[model samples]
Target chain A: MWLTSKIKQLLMVMKPGVVTLNYPHERPPVPANLRGQPVFDHQKCIGCGGCSDHCPARCILVRDVCQELRVMLYDGSRCTYCGRCADICPEQAITMSNSFEIACDQKEDITTRMELFMMTCQRCGRCYEMEKTNAIDRINLKGFRYDNLEQRALIRKTSETFDPTLLQQSDQYQRPSTKE
Target chain B: MSKRKELEAKLIARLRDDVVCVEKTDPRTIFIDVKRAGIREASKIITNAGARYLCSVGYDNIERDGTLGMIHTFALDDSDQFVCCRTSAPENDAIIESITPDLPSAGWSEREVTDLLGLRFAGHPKPKKLVLADDWPDGIYPLRKDVPHNLVPKGAEDVAYELDEAPPGTKIVPVGPFHPSLHEPEHFAVYVDGETIKGCDYRGFMTHRGIEKLCTTQISYNEVPFIAERICGICGSVHATAFSQAVESAAGLVIPRRAEFIRTMMLEFERIHSNLLWLGVAGHLIGFDTVFMQAWRVREQIMWLCERLTGNRKTYGMILVGGVRRDITPEIADDIRRVMKTIEDDLAIIHRAIEKDTSIHKRTKGVGTITKQQALDWSLVGPVARARGVDIDARRDHPYAAYDEMKFEVPVLDSCDVWATLVIRVIETFEAIKIVRQCLEKMPGGEFFVEMKDSIPAQRHAITVVEAPRGESVHYVITGEDNRPERWRVRAPTFPNLQAVPLMLLDEQFGDFPIIMGSIDPCFSCTDRVAVVDLQTGQASSISKAELDALSRQQQARHASLKG
Candidate 1:
């Protein structure tokens, strides 16, 4: 019985011969639907901040440098590549590229920064419209978002207008420390 | 009378004034609110009515009513229904009776509740900080509404968890934090005399990321499926589907038929890969590298297939609250069928090769043996319980997703050992392939994703179960304001199965520890670190990898000599 079993195992092992791929030299073609690092189209973006609000990882941060310009930053270091931003983008500005080999030394290589020009609402200073019926899909952070860009911190607090005091407070935003 | 009414009548008859009220949230779910004093008796009555214990869920209700709530959930598999016994206590005097004395599986749940929510269980056996670190400051329960999700309290140095006392005359062998055999970070102190095991004590949850608290406080409903998928690398779709189903049930949302079929196919794909993965790992644990290599090679096809279908290899992120995110095109369906065919043929070849191998039988047969009654007592699930002849499969019983229309066989064995688990997993892989074929053939044409018309009303509770490849995964969700769940509790399959490890490890050969633990296919990737300590002399030492390998080899040599 042992000999027969060994013979069968030998056949099984011999059938699948040398399946390992030689990577870096011989590359396999990636599928069309692979959700890799996301690429942002600056001209197509509307500065709605929908992708930032819907992001599960919160890797995308939206900050308003002024009333006219909104800086959207994608920190690839923490990105999960689940592609929620691409799915939720209203203008189809975000696309999950086919680039799976994104290993690099600096985070800036994979990161994408977009400076979008915004047109504010005439009735209100903010650019957001509360017209969506579903409350969960609505963008909660309206007006100028003053997230700390240097610290890569998403300050959940926002102002109705571009307030320098709030921006300065955000600049001093340190993580909550343990009470001694 | 219906099964729900019959159970409700029995509970109300037994505890007349203690039965507060009974509410049926849906047809299959019955929520019975009993007074805190009669919880034990109520649980007994439900169990007497043939209800299998699932898990306990504890949540903070202090902000609204100054009370803490506890719900003990059970499944009436014979009748296809669920019975949830709900009871709460005031925050000032939060003490509830522990059901662990009767249902041993509730031990971890109650301890976890005590650690996270600060709700004490009066008669809990060995309730010494299950989920919290030893140095975690008291009076700071992280699950409460007022506590922030990102609170990092100061860590007190030099404090360590006090493990249970080793049995008399048995040497302690600490098997993890980082052992060669264990892929995850969990510590098991096994008491052994010579080559035989006496008892075991486990200290895990070291890598608990507080996901429940994060999802409840930080993220919204739509984003939770993605986070929930990260709960387990192997069964990502299972957690995501269960969470989405729980929310959908709570909101009374009816998804499209095509979406259900797609969800079912995704779940089956996960089962195929996961079972094959377990098979390979089991082989590796038993020192049989041939089976490991062959099984994993067969599984790689499914991985590539999933990457094409769901846009990633694992964590499909395909499921949402209303429906699935991706639609199955005809070409993708053909691709799935082709992959399933190749996997079926290759797995059969591997199965035939290993089925009659004497070496595998010598290693796995009669190892990790637990009786059917003991398995039921610990509320073990999946292949572990099925191997022990406790026939329960959530897919057929609960019929979630598109399983109600699909027909498949659930293989059960009476061997009650690791060999049976291996055989059952292989058979179930074949069955999963069959289910995927049925799903593709019978899939209806409709919308893949649906938009929620209205906002989910707050304070509605729902529970859902999805049969992960490992076992039954239960998810309970309560809708809250701010588009997030008020309190979401996830009970992974490993939660109950791992609790019964000590019972399975009793009286087994010490050298067979790795294969025995690996028999359950524990998803311990979230856990890390290892140390060895002598309980009698109070001396701490770390065992090197070479020493552990030598020790195991020595034991194996002794066993072989005795057999010869």
Candidate 2:
């Protein structure tokens, strides 16, 4: 009984229900929600260094040089691919791409670079967040609108004003790139 | 009337003078600050009160208070209540009485405390290098604030781990710092009297990548869960979920109900894949590659399903501190059920074949038998305990995530052997499928994320347990300033189960070592996180067979000289 059943089981397994994927030549079916190469939307990136703070592996680097420009460098090698940067981005700048096959021989191949102009907080007079993204959503998230009305009004009032020469700060931050 | 209060009262009553302060952190957890002098007695009281010893966390709080802290966590599995006995020792003379003499399960933990935090355990049976590389210099404690996490001592001295000498009349058959059987770098000296295994001595922790030090020292609170996911490739979600829950609990952040349900679904999904993978590995261990191939074939479906559901095939980085990153839509729910059904069908055939097959039964049945008493004494969890009829599942006992809402069976078999463990895993896989189906059916709709607006103050400690595929995974988190954990200790299921392997391997045939180890579903990646020195030569690298033999001789001489 055991031998016959075992033979039957072996034959059943041989029915070709289970199959191996033909890869390299034939692409493996990647799901729509697959977290792959981190896509940086340069337009939406406010250079607040939020992604760096949210990154668990410290794969993201946001260095604000002399309060003029914010240099954001993402080393994909160091990234755990947790997609926290995409999830926690206040302006929804970072999102995951489906291109997960990020294998490369050279170090430069995996590195992602995005530079944005630094914007200073008018109230604190300290450089805070990346420039060019709407700051009202953040004000709401910090609960400043409900918690303190005066600070919210000040933030809103400051939003109307900007450094006239801020547009001429750097050509690097003005690059129209949203590479996924 | 409450079990938590009763346990606390029992602890305080037994050690009235010893209990300095009993702080009820939550309804289910109590932190009893007991005198360092009476720590052993306090621990014994908690254990005797039907609380299983979870793990001990040793933290170096020298910067703030000139003292080291040790927290012994115990779980009264029935009431899902956790009792943590906190004690402190002066940094200058950081010494605490070891509980290992009574609770043998805490042996490795105490040794680890001695290794990483440099806290001396007075009565630890084998107080040796449990975490660090053997060649690591004396007085270079990695976890201490003074010694930075990345500080590699210039020219680390070569001090090989001193392995236990082979018993008289038994020849030592050393198997791996690198062996076919062991997936990771680990040294095991199996003493055999002509194939009848006499005794076993293991010198492992070679894969200790210093994750605890890395995370606590560098990583922030939000990012820790991702690093926790990398702890074990197979059971990454277990660690991630446990660490996230621990952080959330510490901060008093109650996540959304839907988020909890999603977490439950993901964990069960992980269980399905991990169990199938283990079954395949077990098959491979016993020289049945056909079963291995078939099992893996069944498992790949779940892997694909997981990828489809949560982005990645393995490290489903879907979970965050407050909630899951992704949501389970109706379409995804149907997809999960379809995949689980297919896997269920595949596993059924394999299980029946193994059950009816005489060769499998002859090889596995009555081999590596662990009695219920032995299982309890060693504090084994997961299928290992269940196979021995211990009937302890952290899901049913502790009820973390949405497990309380989900209905599933915790299969307990009294056969108490490798065969029983094999059967338990098979049945548990089906149960996991059932759980995932129920989660998909009963999942509530709401926001998947909760933003933590309040600044989590420092020094709030929390303990969280996730019933991982292997067993129960425990994570202890103490919230610190600067948006990071002051101390995060993870006690993986393999950490305790691997300790009990020698007990399982005592007199069994040496040939059955692979299957026995495989049966435990040992995930060294989670248990160890740094480079460990070899037992013989005091180096981290694998040496030649001849060199290893010579080192074994040196170890033997060292033991002989000490004995003499």
Specify the highest-DockQ model's number.
1
Against the true structure, whose TM-score is highest? 1
Q: What 10-residue stretch in candidate 1 chain B is worst by lDDT?
A: B526-535
lDDT of 2 at B363: 77
The residue-by-residue lDDT of candidate 2 on B1-564, one tens digit each, is 676567668767777787788888788788889889889988888888889999999998888889999999999988788999999999889899999989899999999999988899997788878787766777778888676665646434345778887889999999997899988878888999998788888888878888888777665676777888888988888888998898888888898999999999889888988898988898899988888888888888888888898888988887778788888888888888789889888788887777778877877998888789989989998998899999889898888889989888889999999999999999999999898888888888989878776667899999989999999999999988766788899999998898898888888998899998889998887888553434546686977756876787698788647433
- lDDT for every model? 0.88, 0.79
lDDT of 1 at B503: 87
Off by over 4 Å in 2: A64-67, A115-180, B1-14, B530-564
Query: What share of the reference contacts is kept in model 1?
Result: 0.65
Residue B333's lDDT in candidate 2: 80
lDDT of 1 at A49: 84
Docking quality band of candidate 2, CAPRI definitions? incorrect
Candidate 2, residue B10: lDDT: 77
- Candidate 1: stretches off by over 4 Å: A122-135, B525-564
